[model samples]
Target: MAKRRFGRVRQLSSGRWQARYAGPDNVDRPAPQTFDRKKDAETWLVQKEAEILAGDWLDPDAGKIVFLEYARSWIEERPNLRPRTVELYDYLFRLHLKPTFGARALADIKDAHVRRWRKDLLDNGVSAVTTAKAYRLLKAIFNTAVDDLLVRRNPCRIKGAGQEKSPERPVLTVAQVYALADAIEPRFRALVLLGTFGSLRWGELTGLRRRDVDLDAGTVRVERQLIRITGQGLVFTEPKSAAGKRTVVFPELIAQDLRAHIKDFAQDGDDGLIFVGPDDGPLWNSNFNRRFWGKALTDAGLAKIHFHDLRHTGNTLAANAGASIRELMDRMGHSSTRAAMIYQHGSHERQREVADRLDSLARGQLKSGSGTQRARKPKKAE
Candidate 1:
């Protein structure tokens, strides 16, 4: 390989001091501007030389594609991405990002542009969390452009970049959970109960096959999830994370329900879905929610709650049962303990009980010591 070399200061025909350098391919390249003096030219040459040695130099003008064009190419290149992930990326790009930065050249984009866009989004009644997601999507796109040599750096790296904190989830009472479970139709009874006890995600619960459950062992193996993506209907995929692939041991009531479920409504084959449509195919999540979930809540006379809240209810119940943080984390298949902690915040009554127990134990110990001191008449005299 030819050793990179810096061009010496030379007076241009326009009476300006010019600096040049040999690129990696041994091609001579000139600076965009000529300096007023040899010192200035030498300073420019030194900076360029260092950048070239560090392998951080780019032509800047090369591949100056517009953000829209680069984004399309980026999406196209991700052939191995999950269908759901691709759908979300496409939606984010088209609905949120492209309208803002699509026309701008990748090289011309800067951190200030991103900051301004974020401010505009927040001003337009968009939640901080939404703005943060948009920012993340833009950052990912620009990072891809950088990787593909379409841009120098990601402009989304401005300080204080991230989504705002979401609202805290409300914990449902045990009475409310049981009431909802009771009001739901018999067909969906097991589903509601399982969600309230197992904390299984909607997809994971819907994706369960008969063979994945072992009623005798009182365990349900969660190995897959059913995802419905835009432009693609229903597809079964592995759990979102390794932690999502777990086995949850249900209580005896749940185990008995499973056994009965197998006997009464079980499909012909072991591979048949535990939850299916009237046609015995995979159930559509939207249909299930609209047809059954809403009526169940209304009948139960409870505030309208999301189907996913059952999972939260399960976590709360497990914590109230004195299950440790690690055990709750395992049951919920949470990738991080942080998320499990959010669900483990039990009711105020439970908190008070814990405090009372500790206080009573302390008082008992003090009383015992006091009795011991009184019994030691000689020691008291001393």
Candidate 2:
């Protein structure tokens, strides 16, 4: 490392005098800096030397590239993402990210600027979770720029970066489930029943075909989901993930109800949609939720919950009935066990029953009166 001393200028063989500062990376790299006079070199070198020693020396050239230009390039390069996902990314960029650092060059973005942005988001009443998501998007964008050599480092690496806790969803009780079922119109009753018992999502429920239900086998095949896109509107697509394509079994009673439902309401063709509008076309999510679900829940005299809560209620009931974590995951089509565990919090009665069974097995009470304990019966028979 070059010793820190002002006015110590070196004249190269080319007769150009330049000031040099050793980088913290433990190498004597040139600063690409030039000076017209020895005094100028000394002043520049002294200020740089102090900053380097303070462990805060950053090259200013990095902060020169504007963030908006890089963000546009980033969005354009990703063509394979789903339309809904792309729309969300674009929304986050325009509403949150771009407005903050749109004009700032990539090289000029600093840790302090990122910190202030996070604070401003909180001050503006944006939820911590949304802010965190936006932060991650920004981090990903800048990290790509770093790989491309557009910037020295990502400024998003500072601590307290992302959102923390996700909001909790309320689970419904068995009585509330029945009330919700009874309150809806008879035409949409099966929809509520399938959602509550089978744990089908809104898209999955609306995407069902007559052939997907096997009444004798008591199973429903989940093959596709309805997705609402911004520009193209509603379309049926394959399940979001492989795990989402699954078979769910229901009780024989529910299966019987489904059979009757088809015989009376559903069309004869196998390709006919199981749940459709009065004109036999695809069901619109907004119209169904507004006309059927909202009024049903209100009449049931229960808390206002979204249609998606029916799926949660199903998972909760299964968990309370002693369903294993893996079984619940498979039924819910959850790609991971983490979310399924949240719905597995059952009542104290179930927990106590499990504890008592475990205690009996551990204490050898199960073998106390077995056939091996027979006494004198063989002698009497002889």
Candidate 3:
């Protein structure tokens, strides 16, 4: 076989040519693949020589590190991630990413591998929302790998694979919200009302303290949130974003109930938890869902719903009440306007607008009606 200045090629027993060269680090490296012809092998060596001379060569052996090790280190190296976010990353790695890619080398992961893994997850009935989160995580890990030069390019190139097409969450009407609040145990009535009208997240509402709430002023300060992370149990942490730290001025309609809750259920100290379970401890979601939420759904004749839907309902109410995008973002504690836009630009509400206009066009032919209606049951709470 012929020799080259950059690399050498030798014919294999099967008549294929293998290329070997000294990399810029002076380490002898082999071409990743054997070539069908000596010329092909020499061509690869030439390209590697050019890359080395141009300072664009990446050490192939670096990518031999297993994906699991790199991914774990990636999560660990990140600074200032919320504990719940770290927990979620761990969860996704364990359940979704680890099973398929953990043992594989970073260099071995390909776009096809990601596509097949995503397809298998969907086929196995894993939720799209969950799959999307996992996919995004995988993509992010690979992104860092590219930046670190572990791999030449990101393997996660599927378009729209990272976007979650979450179903529209159910929102409770004012009457329904009030009925559900009343149907729950008396101690949690104010908790439920605050969740709806104030758009308080589960973590924020459960983490409230006597010092954080001013019943007379009808404002609740959101300085912190309580999150339950696996292994660590309940942890009190700052809000997810800076916008989450803002205070909310709630409707005066619920002031009476707030005072009653404070008097009947709250502790005297400033640091006292605003909401608690029967054990008079930190309010746990599992206990509340099993003991209160399930029963409240039955008594109020409402269908199954997640607790976060209360915040969803509150956001919708605020949007219907003409809250601006910034106002909604502040109330919902969102870092961006994308989530707020979902509530403001709902297709169902737009369809109603079209129907109402069409109804007006036909008003001459039909009898006049009550026009529009709004629920007024929240004020009726005893």
* The best candidate in terms of lDDT: 3
Rank by TM-score (best first): 3, 1, 2
lDDT of 2 by residue, 288-329 (tens): 877777888889998888889889878888898878899999
- Specify the poorest-scoring 10-residue window by lDDT in model 3: 368-377
* Residue range 130-233, candidate 1, lDDT tens digits: 77877887888878778777677788976656756887655678688778877987767788888878889999988998999988888899999998976668
Error of 1 at 166 (Å): 2.0
The prediction achieving the highest TM-score against the true structure is 3
Residue runs of model 1 more than 4 Å from their true location after superposition: 1-5, 8-22, 26-42, 76-80, 144-150, 370-382
Between candidates 1 and 3, the one scoring higher on lDDT is 3
Clashing pairs in 1: none
- Give lDDT for model 1: 0.81
RMSD of 1: 5.0
In order, what is each prediction's RMSD in angstroms? 5.0, 8.6, 8.7
Q: Compared with the true structure, what per-residue lDDT tens digits does model 3 show for residues 177-285? A: 9999889999999989999999999999999999999887889999999989988899999999998998998999999999999888986699999898887899999
**Model 2: how far is 223 from its true place, Å?**
1.4
- After TM-score superposition, what is the CA distance of residue 369 in candidate 2 from its true location, in Å? 13
| Model 2 spans with C-alpha error above 4 angstroms | 1-64, 158-164, 359-382
Which 10 consecutive positions of candidate 2 have the poorest summed lDDT? 370-379
Task: Report the C-alpha displacement of residue 229, candidate 3, in angstroms.
Answer: 1.7
